[model samples]
Target: MLKKIYPLVFFISLYSYAQTSVNFTDNFSGIESVLYNPANIADSFYKVDINILSSSTTTGNTYSTVKPLTILKDNKFGLNDLDVFKKISSLDATIDTIFKISKLKDLDSYVSKKEFSEDSNFYGNSTILGPSFLWTVNNYNTVGFTTAIRFNGYAYNFNSELYNQFTEKTYLNNPKKLLDNNFGNLTGYGQAFAWYEVGFTYAGVPIHTPTEFFKVGVSLKFLRGIKTYSFLLNDFTSNFSLNEDVPEDSVLDFNGSVSVSSSDTGANYGQGLDIGIVYEKRNKTLPINNIDKHGNIYYSKAPYSFKISASITDIGFISFNNIKTQTNNVDLNLANSNFAISDYLSIGSNKNQKETYLLPTTGHLNFDYNLNNHWYLNTNLDVYLFSKDRINAMKTVSNISFTPRYESQHISAFLPLSINNFGIYKAGFGIKTGLFYAGSSSVLTNLTNLSKEGDFFIGLKIPIYNSKVVSEYKKGIRKYSLLKIIENIDEEENTDSEL
Candidate 1:
C-alpha cells in the first residue's frame, strides 16, 4: 500500500505546485475597493480632505490542521486511521477534479509535488490617502485635479508540519511521531501593495445667479501600481520512534529549528475616468407689503441657503505584469533527489508570464445646508462597486462599503459687510458615522476594533484678504476744487510772513 501511494502522492505534489503559485489578481484589487467615484475632484474647493476608516468581522475560520483531522482507528498493519486518510484523499481529489473538469490537465502538468500543500492563513490591513484641488479658470468654467495612494500589507502562517506528516510515509498514524515532526509550528508569508492615480477635471456653470448656480464636470486619470511578496519557512530538528507503529500518547520532542526567507516584486500601469455635478444656493430676500417700525415697511434677510454635489471616480482600469516566488525548509530524508537548494532559496519560475487585474472604479455623493450665519450641516455617502478583478480573485465574492458624515460650524465674531472685503473666519465641530462595507468592514478594519462603526471630526476654516476700503475723507480729498487750492496757498503765505 505504501509503495502504491508513493506514486499517487508524487503526482499530487507536482500538480499542487503548478496550481499554488499566487495569482496576481488576488492582491491587486485591495486599493480599488475604496474608491467611490472619480468625479469627487470636480466638486471639491481648493482644500485638503483626509478621512480615516476601519472595520473587522469574525466571519472566516482560523487555520488549524489538528482540529480538522482526528484519529478514528489505529492498527499494527501500517497504523490505520480512516479520518486522516479521508481528509487527505478529499484534498487530492478536489485538486485533481478541478484540473480535469476545467480541461487544465495539460496546463497543470508543470506543477511539482511541493506546491500541492501550500496552505496558509490569509489576512491583512490597508490605508488610503486622497488629495484634490479645484481652480476656477473663469466665471463660467473651472478645472480640478486629484491624486490618491493606497497601501495594503498582510501576514500569513503556513502549517508545514501537518502537510509533511500527511504526505511522508514515515510519520503515518502515530501522534507521537507526528508531534516529533513539529507539525503545528507556524511559517510566515506577507505582501505589500501600492496603487496611485492622478486625475484632471473640467467644470462649467451654464446658469448662474447671485443666489444660485449649477455646474457639471468630468475627469481623466493615470494609474500606476506595485506589489511585493515575502515567504519565510522555519527549519526544525525531529525525533523518530524505532518502532514502525507508535502509541498515540508516546512522547517525542523537538531539539532545534531553522529558518529561510524569499521575496519577489512586480509592477503594472493603467488609467481611469470621473464625472460630477454641483448645485449651490445662497441667501435671498422675499417681497412683503406691511407696516413696520416708524410707520415704514421693513424687510428681513432670508436664512442661509444649501449646497449639494455628487461624483464617480476610477471609472476605468489598467493591466500589468506578474511576479512570484517561493521558499521552504524540507527534511533531508524527504527532500527529492531532483530538488535543488536554490529552488527553496529564491523565486524560481513564473516570472513575467502572468497579468493581473485591478479593482473597479467608485462613486460618491455629498450634501450640505447652511441654516444661518452661525450654524450649518454637512454629509457624504460613498459606494464602491466591486471590480471584475476583485470578483475573480475572491472566487466571485461581492463586496461594497457605505460612509456618511454630519458637521456644524459656528462664528464667534463677524466682520462689517462691505464690497470687496478681504477678512473672514469660522470654526466647527463634526461627527461622522463609521465606515460600513457590505459583508465586512472597510479595509482599515485590522488597525481599529471600532465596533460602533463611526468617527468624530473637528476642524476650522479661516480667510484673510488685502483690499482698498473707500472712506469719506478719501472720497472728499479726491474731489479737489480751484477755490480750495487758492485758500490753502493764501494760508501758507500768511504763515510764512508771521514767521
Candidate 2:
C-alpha cells in the first residue's frame, strides 16, 4: 500500500530545515521579515532591500534524527563505499544470521528507522525565495514584493500495528498466528504538494504619537500549484493466513476504503493573504523630527524600546484541476487469494477530478524588548490554524521560541531556544553579515544526531539604508540621537585628556 511512499520520504530527506528565522525581530532584516510579519517593514532600517536568492527546509518526524545535510556531508567526507543498508546490515552478525533464515533484510536495525509511538506523525516543508525586493515609499508607508516556491508534506494518525506490517516480514511473510486474528479500525492520511507564489505587500504606520506607535500591513499573493499527491485511509480491516512452508503463498481478507489523488496536468491557480499588526512603546530618549505623513523622510535608527506584534499567514487554498483520483471500497472474502495488495487494489476505476487543497495557515505572536542600542530579546509563538485531521490542508508544526540577539548596522547575531508541539527542544544560532545570512534551528541536535528534526537555511540580499538620514545630518535638519550624542561627547572628552 505504501510502495510509492518511498519517493516522498526521499524527497523530504533532501530538503530538511526549519521554518521561521531567528532574526525576524532585527530592525535591519528588511524584506525578509515580510514572511513572518509584514508590519515589520514599516520603520525599518532599509530604504531598499533586494533578495537575490534564499532557500530553507524543515524536518520533523517521530522517527530518526538524520538530517539531509548530515547525510550529504557523510557521503562527501566519509571514505567507505558501503551504502547505508550495507553498513546497517553489517552492524549485528547474529541478527544478520537470523535474517538469513527468513531471506529478508533486517531493517529494524537501521539507525534512522521509524518508530511506532503513541503519537506517530511526520511533517516537512521547504521554501525558496526568488528575486524579491522591498522599497520604503515615504515616512509612513512601505511596500514590497516577493516570489517563492514552496513544498509541504505530512502524515498523521499512523497506527503502530499497520506500520509493523510494512516493516516486519514476520507479520506477513512467515507462518505465524494472526497477531490480532482481525485487525480493524485503522485510519491515517498523508499528503504532499508543491506550489509557487508571487506576492505584493503594503505596510504603513497608522498612528504615531509621542509615546505610542501602531503599524499595520497586508500581503496579497497569487499562487500556482504545480503538483500534489494525497491519500486518506478512512477505515481498514484485514485478516490473513500464511503458508508455513511457502511465505509467498498467503490468503488474506481485506476490507477498507481509501481516497487517493495525484496531479496530472496543467498548473492551478489560487489567492492567499497575510495580515499583521504591530504596536510600539516609543523610546522617549531618541531624538525625532515629526513630519507629515506624506513626507519623504525615514528614521535613522530604531526608535522603540519595546514592541508587540501579531500576524496570520498563508490564508488561502489551491485547486488541482487536472488530477487522477480514486476512492476505493474493498470487501473480499476467500475470493481474494494470490493477488498482491497492490494488484487487487487497482480493481477500481480512476477518474479525472478537481480537488481544492488548503495551505498550511498559521498564526504568530511576538514580543520584542530592547536591552540597549545593540542588544534585544524576543519571544515568539507560532500555532497552526487548521486541524491535523483536515486531510486537504497542508500541515505545519507549532512552536514557541525565545531569542537573544546583538544587532548593528552591518552585522547581527542571534541565539534561539525553542520547543515544538512534539515536546522537542532545540537550540540554534544565526548570523547576518552584510548581505549574507545562514542558520539552523536544530543546529545542536543535528550535530549530535539526537533530535528528531533538523534545519538549515542561507540567503543573500542587497540592502540600501536611508540616505535621507545622512543628508539631514549634513544639512543641519537633524542632529545625533541621544545615545549617539552621548557617545560622541565621551569620545571628545577622552581625546582632550589624551592631548
Candidate 3:
C-alpha cells in the first residue's frame, strides 16, 4: 500500500514560490491588480469597475513535464483510485532512472539528507468569483472590494530517509541511518476556503506639488474555512529492519509529534487585512481634463506619470474550532481493537480537535515608468514573509521582474521578463481589449514539455473610465433637478436683464 502511494502523493509538494502572476502586478486598469498590491488602486484609470466574473489557476510540482510513469502505463490512475489499488506494487530500473532527479544528493550533516532540494513545494488549484467592485469617485479618491474562493494544497520537507524507503523495493538499507537522528522535520497543511473582502480606499492630492503625488489603500477580508484537511510532522523518529528476508519482532517502528486528518466537523473563521501606499510623478507636460457624469469637468492628476508603490498584504490568520486534528490523546486508532501501538511507546497517540491556521503574508514593491504616451516600463518585487518554518503559510518566493507594455485608454499589451521565486527565468505575455485582460506568468512551462509550474489570470468587467464620463444634457445644462433647472434659467434671465 505504501509503495503504491509513494508514486502519487510525492508529487504534491513540488512547487516553490507559487503565485507568479507577474502580468497582474502592474495592470492598474484591471481590478485584479489590487490583489498584487492594494496601493495599485491609486493608479486605476476607470471611475467604476465591476468585475462580473474572474478566475485564475496556478500549479507546480517537482516532476518534469515528461512523466515516465504516465507514459509507461496506458491507463492512468491516481493513488486514491480504487483501480490502482488492485495492481501489484513494482519498481524497475527504467522507472528509477526517470525519477532519479528527485533523489537526495550530498549535503552537510547539519542538514537533513532527506531533502531533494532546499525548495520542494506545491500550491494551487485556485478559483475566485463574485462581482468585485471598484470606484474612483473623484480625482483624489479610489476604492474597491473583491471576493474570492481560494482552494489549495501545499507540502514540504520530504527527507531522504523517507524517500528511499518508500521508493525502494529491492534491498532495505540501514534503518538506523535512514531514521534515528536523520529523520528531519516535515510540515505541511492544506485547506479549501472562501473569503469575502470589502476594501475602502482614498487617494488625494499627493506628497509634494501637482507633479508628484502619494496615496494609500487598505483591504479588509473575512475568511470562512469551508472544508479543510491538514497534516503536520515535527521531530519524527523511525527504526526498521534492514533485512527483508527475515521477519523480526517488529518490522517498522516510528514515533514523533505528528498530526494527520481527513476533514474537520466544525466551522472555522478568520479575519485579515492588507495595506499599501503609492507615489507617482506626473508628466504634467499637458493639462488633462475629464468630463463627469453630471456634465462637469475635473482635472486628471494621474496622467502619464511614473508610479512607484509599496505594500504588505495578507497579514492575518484563521481560527478553526473542533477541527479534525490529530491529538496526542490516550486512545490509539488502528485496526483490531485488541492491539494498540501507543501502549508500548510513550508517543504517537493523538486525537482530532481544533487548530488555528495562518494566512500567507507577502510584501510587494513596484515601479511603473511611463515612456511617452503609450509605452510604459514596470518593475515589480514580491517576497514571502514566512519561510518554511511557519505553519500553513503561503509566502511567495521573492522575485523581481520588469515588464514593457503598450497601454491606451481601451487596449493594452505587455511582455514581461522575470526571474521567478525559484530563480527560473520566465518570459510571459498579456493583452487587454476594453475591460478584459488575460495572460500567463510563465509561458515556458505551458508551451513546452516542462511542467514545473505556470500561472494564468483572466477577468471580465464593465468599467467606467474617467475620460469617458459623458452627460446626456447640452452644454451648461442645469441637470441637478427640474426645480433647480427652472431656478437657474430664471436667474440667468434676471442677470441678463441687469446686464
Ranking by lDDT: 2, 3, 1
lDDT of 2: 0.72
* Alpha carbon lDDT of each predicted model: 0.36, 0.72, 0.56
Reference-based lDDT, residue 110, model 3: 12
TM-score of 3: 0.69
What value does the lDDT take at residue 150 in candidate 1?
48
lDDT of 1 by residue, 305-421 (tens): 666767776566555566543333343332223545543333324445344444444456666565433244445544555532232121111222222222211112111111100
Question: For residues 1-499, could you state the per-residue lDDT of candidate 2 as single tens digits?
Answer: 5423432343344333335333344777788889989888986667789999988777777654444444454343232445533643452434334234323333323235456553467777788889999998877889999999988888777665555554565656643644335555567788899999999999999887656888999999999999998877777777766665765565667778888788987869989999999998865444454543566433334346788999999999999888887788777654334555565454454666778988889999999997765678999999999987776788999999899999766788888888898887888888887699988767876555566776667899998877665354333222334566778899999999999
Q: How many residue pairs collide in each prediction?
A: 24, 3, 11
Off by over 4 Å in 2: 1-25, 67-70, 76-114, 165-174, 177-186, 241-252, 289-303, 335-346, 470-499
The 10-residue segment with the lowest total lDDT in model 1 = 19-28
lDDT of 3 by residue, 1-499 (tens): 2243233444332222233343464444656777766666664566777888877766654423323223224223223445333332334323233233333121111111232543355555565756787787665667777778766565554443455454454435644444323333333343344444444444443544435666777787787776666666555544444443443432444555556554455567788888888777763432233344665433333343577888887799876675555434223232233565647444343345566767778888888897755578988887878875676564445668888988755678888777756545666788777768788767654454444556667778887765533222111122223434577899999999999
Looking at model 2, residue 352 earns an lDDT score of 66
Q: After superposition, how far is residue 366 of candidate 2 from its true place, in Å?
A: 0.6
Worst 10 residues of 3 by lDDT: 104-113
Report the Cα RMSD per candidate: 22.9, 7.6, 12.5
